[model samples]
Target: MSVNEIDEQGLGPQARRSEATKRALLDAALADMEATGEASIRITKILQESGVTNGSLYHHFGSREGLVQAAIAERFLGSVTKGLAVFAHRVGEVGSTEQLFEVFRDELVRIGSPDVQTQRIHRMTALAAALPRADLLERIIADQGRYFDGAADSLARLQEHGFIRFDVDVRAFAAWFLGLSLSRLLSDIDPQLNPDNEWSEYTFRALVAILTPAPSAH
Candidate 1:
């Protein structure tokens, strides 16, 4: 009867079908929102587009609002996770701080510009503001910490290579940069904001400017 109930039954053919239906519905919702810039979407439209039945929709997502929130979460976090994975792979291969940041900046620009992602960021901001449960807040904080850990590794590598000033605090720098980037993503995601004037480029340049490098011997 409930989404959780469906999930609890384990992965059977029907379960997989249900999961796929949910994915399709969410994908449809995102595509529709991006095309029309509409904030409110109907579950019936999503079901119709996804080619899923009403019962399947109900089994997959508790309600339209919950589906919207889940879709938002999936798109935003999925992009972020993909970007971080790329950065991690690059760093692991070359062990170069410069290379890591290069990949990171490019990925951020791509992720931050998309309409679906921007919408998700806006949703996340609203959810965080209104949600008062301590456990929910704790999970949000923990998720943030995990995300920061990936960036912190690259900063630490920069410090190790003497690309950054020794006095610089890696965790603090990572936190500050991450916060700034996420804020930018939130702003760009808002449908009302017209941020088409090289915002990401400027942000990347600012980051490179502030990251003080050590003096090299002549």
Candidate 2:
């Protein structure tokens, strides 16, 4: 069932109120983290910003660490999910391999842009934070699974339309594409290694070579 459906059918009024309080705390925590560039947020500050009680914070999230982790998962993974969904939609709309490659080239340029690179760095930072915590890591893994599955489905559709190579494993290709996008983080940190155009051109060429189907053997 959908989250809204579950909220409406499974939760009582008090539970819904509690969920709202939890959301408020998460939003406050995420905002503070973003503003301060700190992963660990002060509980008192979060309580003040959220207008929720300390007791409510512990009751909802168990601890300040729990609250921060939840906030990271909510914001970072949620952003990735939304991004993948949009890309999947774009992939579905293309009528030919050239159009697909055009969309991908556009995505490469867009992601390599300064603003999006900052977002990508934030995602990597969030991922690092999640790595030590088992629960958070599991959440990240689950979200990534969804991302891969969604992208693979889109690629499979394109393959059916003869846009992608028949021999390619759509799931593996999806993972590779995501890895390529995230690889920009290496350049993001270095001042002397700005190869935006060269990187995009190389990546686009690699994708074209990998995705293009071979001629029929007569």
Clashes of each: 1, 0
- What do the candidate models score in CA lDDT, each in turn? 0.64, 0.83
Name model 1 segments beyond 4 Å from true: 1-12, 36-38, 93-144, 182-205, 213-218
Off by over 4 Å in 2: 1-16, 35-40
> What is the C-alpha lDDT profile of model 2 across 61-149, one tens digit per residue?
89888888888888668768767877988998999988999899778877877777767876887888889889999998888878999
lDDT of 2 at 203: 89
* TM, every model: 0.62, 0.88
The TM-score of candidate 1 is 0.62
Candidate 1 RMSD to the correct structure: 6.6
| lDDT tens digits, residue span 66-181, model 1 | 66656655554565566567666665554454765676576565556565365446445534532654544454555566767887786677678776667777677777866666
